[model samples]
Target: MVEFTDWDIFRNLALAARWTVLLSIIAFIGGGVVAGILLLLRMTKNVLLVGLVRVYTEVFQGTPLLMQLFLAFFGLSLLGIDIGAWTAASLAMTLFTSAYLCEIWRGCIDSLPKGQWEASRTLGLNYFQTMRYVIVPQSVRVATAPTMGFSVQVVKNTALASIIGFVELTKAGTMLNNATFEPFKVFSLVALFYFAICYPLTRYSKYLERKLNVAG
Candidate 1:
């Protein structure tokens, strides 16, 4: 067993945490792009497009993220597509994040009064123009808090990527625990690291919610 000092473990875990942050950012941004596309498609109110988006959302939302990671890593290999852990993890996380975000944003948009849509039409605004000028502006205020809250989930979910050998904070903790044989110390530090990353977002989310409620 390689003896790891307390400082050595802290430094290594801190280094690995960077990958966790990077992966979460990639997943959140990629997912946001995809969800934006889906939201637009659903807004079109085309039966076929709506159905397709609904199915896509249901499939990803209903399934476990761990299973999605496994499929992304292993299923593609079975199809003779060579994909690295990073690519597979990114792909799976993006899809999973997109599904949930789509639903969250859709709910926000739907919460608007039908009169708003009618008023937009009254002003001779087309669907896209109305959405761009009116609906989206209002929905953004409603969506901001939940979006930040969801981001915390995204950060924590990066830990799941470690299952597929992504060498993130959780994986580093596991590796260090093996070397140091100190589960209590190693995992406690791991939990602390996650808390440090997530707590601010959580608190900020609550603050936003309260502020928005008061504003509303």
Candidate 2:
């Protein structure tokens, strides 16, 4: 068995933590772009487009992410498409994030006063123009807190990536524990590392929520 000191284990966990942060950013950014497009489609009067977005969101949100990752990694490989674990994990996360974000922003859009929509129409703005110049700007302010809150969820979800043999923080912790025979010590550090990354995000989300008070 390879023996590892506390410092050595912590160092390795920290290094892997960087990958967790990187993947979270990737998933959130990619998801946001995709979700934005979906939201636009939903706002339009296209029945088919709205139904498709609804179904896409339902599929992702209805299922557990762990299963999604498994399908992306192992199931895809079974189809003779050899994708790397990192690629699979990232893509799965992006899709998952997009679904949730689209739903969240849809709610934000709905929260807008009916008068605002009517006023935009009276002002001769097309649907896309209204959303682009007016609705989205205001909805985005309302969406910010919840979106940031969801980002914390995205970061936490990165731990699941370890199951696919991704050497993110959780995987690194598991490896270190196995080598050192120190599950408690190692896992405690793992929890701490996750907190270090997520706590600030949680707090900031809360702050944004209070500041916007869009509900009121």
Candidate 3:
């Protein structure tokens, strides 16, 4: 049996954590782009576009992320498109993050006063123009804190990507544990690493929430 030292485990876990961070950033940014488009659709009065966006949000948000990953990884394989774990993980996380972000931004848009929309229209602004210039600018204050908070979720959720053989932090920890037969120490350290990464963002989100309230 091989005995893994703390340094060895830490080294491997830290290495894999970079991929975790990378994937989270990819997912968050990609999701933000998609969510922004969806937000626009929801704000518009087009019934067909609105219904399609609503269904997209519901389908992504309604399902378990694990199932999404599995379907992306395995289901695609059945269709003769040999997908890698990285692509599947990114695709699933992007979709998952997009749904929640759309909802978050939608809430922010809805929280805007009715008079703002009327006032924008009175100034000869169409829906897109109003959103671009008036509504979104004001809603930034409401959206910032929640968006930051959701980023913490994005980081944590990257762990699920490990299930599909992506060699991220959690997957690295499992491999190290398998070699050392030390699940408790390995997982505890893994948890601590996640905490170290996520705690500051969580705290900053809270701080922004308080600051936004004071500013308002």
Clashes of each: 0, 0, 0
lDDT of 1: 0.95
Ranking by TM-score: 1, 2, 3
Q: Is candidate 1 or candidate 3 better by TM-score?
A: 1
lDDT tens string, model 3, 55-131? 99999989999999999999999999999999999999999999999999888878888999899989999877987
State in Å the error of residue 62, model 3: 0.9
Estimate, for each residue in 1-216, the C-alpha lDDT of model 2 and write its tens digit.
566888899899999999999999999999999999998888778899999999999999999999999999999999999999899999999999999999999998888899888999999998878888988899999889999999999999999999999889999999888898889999999999999999999999999989888777
lDDT of each: 0.95, 0.93, 0.93
RMSD of 3: 1.4
**Mind giving the per-residue lDDT tens digits that candidate 1 earns over 1-216?**
567899999999999988999999999999999999999998786999999999999999999999999999999999999999999999999999999999999999998889999999999999889988999999999999999999999999999998999999999999999889999999999999999999999999999999888256
RMSD values, in order shown: 1.1, 1.1, 1.4
